[model samples]
Target: MAAARRRNSHVQRQRACADSLAEFVERSPSSFHAAAAVADHLASAGFARVEERDEWPAEPGDYVLLRDGAVVAWRIPEEIDDTAPFAIVGAHTDSPGFRLKPSPDRVAHGWRQLAVEVYGGPLLNSWLDRELRLAGRVSLTDGSTRLVQTGAIARIPQLAVHLDRQVNSEGLKLDPQLHTAPVTGPENGPDARSIIAAAAGVEAEDLVAWDLALADTQAPAFLGSDETMLAAGRLDNLVSVHAAMRAIVDTVPSGVIPVIAAFDHEEVGSGTRSGAAGPLLEQVIDRIQDARAVSPSHRARALGASWCVSSDVGHSIHPNYPERHDDGARPIAGGGPILKVNANQRYASDARGAALWAGVCSNAGVTTQPFVSRNSIPCGSTIGPITATRLGVSTVDVGIPILSMHSAREVCAIADAHALERALAVFLAGGWPEHA
Candidate 1:
């Protein structure tokens, strides 16, 4: 059984990682498409779909739903007499990328163009000198809508090497407004009309609204000679979401009610209705109250008994930028999942939660790593802190250590995918003590 589990984990990890990167690239420019992909997966797993307004009261059963690309799914144990304690694993689906505003149109000289705003803190240098395409959601004249990722819309013209002789020595400075505008065509070029026509599915004159941004068409691939590393786009939190899904699916049926949530807009701080810091999770929990009209007292008791794991991405120790990391707490790519800590309470992991997570790693036979920001340096946070406090549940923040977090393309150890799955499975299967 042990060997078989290991073997199965290996296969599952490979398939999950590959599928994750592909989905990440395909569903860019909006979390809506990303959520749709997750909905498809849950549907395939025998989970039934439920609408919030429908008269059929939600009972103790597997249910899933998506909102503007954010997803929340749960399984209600068959024997639930009232509100059962939730074993929840949460991750965000959105990554740092440029977003097209409603009025994306602008004309320069004779060329038509689209305007975009930087969505999150992205590595400006990594975006240079790459083939760029446009993608996102588009609302039509009718009530129905569609996602448009037709093809490469345009490319931000890079300064010529000859114009700047000392280009390599001087590095680069990016003016988002001046240099980032992709040139779709010559002034009044034929390509301009073609792009507008393709986006609207009608003549250029009939187009109403479009939200499009640049994307690299290259597919994700396994990195390193031993294939122990994975390289692809949007690893910030999608990697965590993918790992949580694998873990929940693996251990959900072991008499524990496993829940996996992929919320949108974490990059901009989760302060929205569909964000992790919002009521979507609580609403889903409320839906589980149909079979036994759960009261406020019972709900509080269930919440106190619940456990949550907020999954996000952590910065791996970069070889070239060794000085940027703490000397004693360098998390390597293949090290394992990281237990993030913050003295100022940026991360959700506290002493009690850390110990519980440590035990999960031990039981799963996976190594564990630690991540703490340097005392002198400021720190970045994740959905962990928000979800913990918002839901009022005992929570820990964890993630796969990766390089180039929040960039269009990020790198991570391939083996960490399997390691995270192992740890999360142990967590969902339950045995950890409760905390206040």
Candidate 2:
């Protein structure tokens, strides 16, 4: 009876995690919005905001720091000596999409459309004929900014089947410069600034500039015969961000300090002020050390003992394209979280980091899979190697297996998201044995 009760409890927790992910994706339509939502969550969980310009307090409590589209939150253990290491969970908040150009509002040949630049490597074909909405941060003339989302305000219509009869034999070819523009209306359509102003509850004249992107209008939903799958946009990294946030917020800290670092601009190259390539994470670590008045030697020792789990989505074996994956290391949709390894250092996982993550998963009663890209195919990267190289901390790359990555929409098993959260919570709670 006790074992049965424990099983039921686990099921309940999994259900909660899955439901939370759906809500999080729905609320975060863009990278700026995602960061804001994470900050709100941390604040509600009793994490105080710490401005970078101010000195950090040395008290043991929860705290968070924010850059434009990035966020980092941590909890100080009640007892603070100079020996504790940092346990960090890192994830990106940005995804591939079309960003509006400087002169976005254009009318040509009686059709009013918005010009856009492809922000990252998106599946351009997947965006054709999809209803889209605008969402992002709008900078006002008064030097203030507000988040806005005009739901289902535009669309990219495909050419008729009769007009493109050879489309079946020859797949559709899209030109990012020409065919990807989204239509809003006829020649005399409503102005884009007016629409943004109305949504933001500000005057149209006050809208000086904006950082806007077109997002899918379809709400995320459960798929599969038994409703065990998730279909949504931005799942490539948002899934990781959500899991990390929950783990950091819920886990009780041990001797090690737990941190959540959700960065932006990762899809492009992570080169912005709010990206992993910037100095935000390092500055925060330095501030923490200064607040505690730790000596330089002790600080170096603490950093050497620190570990980071870089959370991002991994590719799942496609039933139709099985040859694309390594036969021995392919991951499945519902197989639980995956540990990504690459000899070329595309990923930062080494044998020691892999063993540490495996132990965390084992302690959480979760199974894990390994992923290595096939020899012929080139592999993509995450923040793992960048963070490790920049901070000199040991790092591992891990995430839930996903399909249709970088598409306007993607797929993953709902159960796998829950499993990843459970394991991440264990890691953040410092369940791993301390290094001698």
lDDT (tens digit, per residue) of candidate 2 on 1-436? 9999998887677768878998999989899999989999999989999998888999889999878889999999889669688999999999998998877787879988988899989999888888999999999988998899997878888888899999989989888888899998897988787777888889988988889999998999988676788899999899999999888887987778899999999999998889998888998998998998989999998899899999999999999999999989989999999999999999999999989989999988899999999999979999999999899999999999999999999999988999898898999988885451
Clash list (residue pairs), candidate 2? none
lDDT of 2: 0.90
Clashing pairs in 1: 32-69, 110-187, 110-188, 229-414
Q: Report, for every candidate in turn, its global Cα lDDT versus the true structure.
A: 0.75, 0.90
Candidate 2's C-alpha runs over 4 A off are: 1-8, 434-436
**244-276 in candidate 1: lDDT tens per residue?**
765666674443467888998888898788898
Q: Which 10 consecutive residues of model 2 have the lowest summed lDDT?
A: 427-436
Judge candidate 1 against the unseen true structure and give its global Cα lDDT, from 0 to 1.
0.75
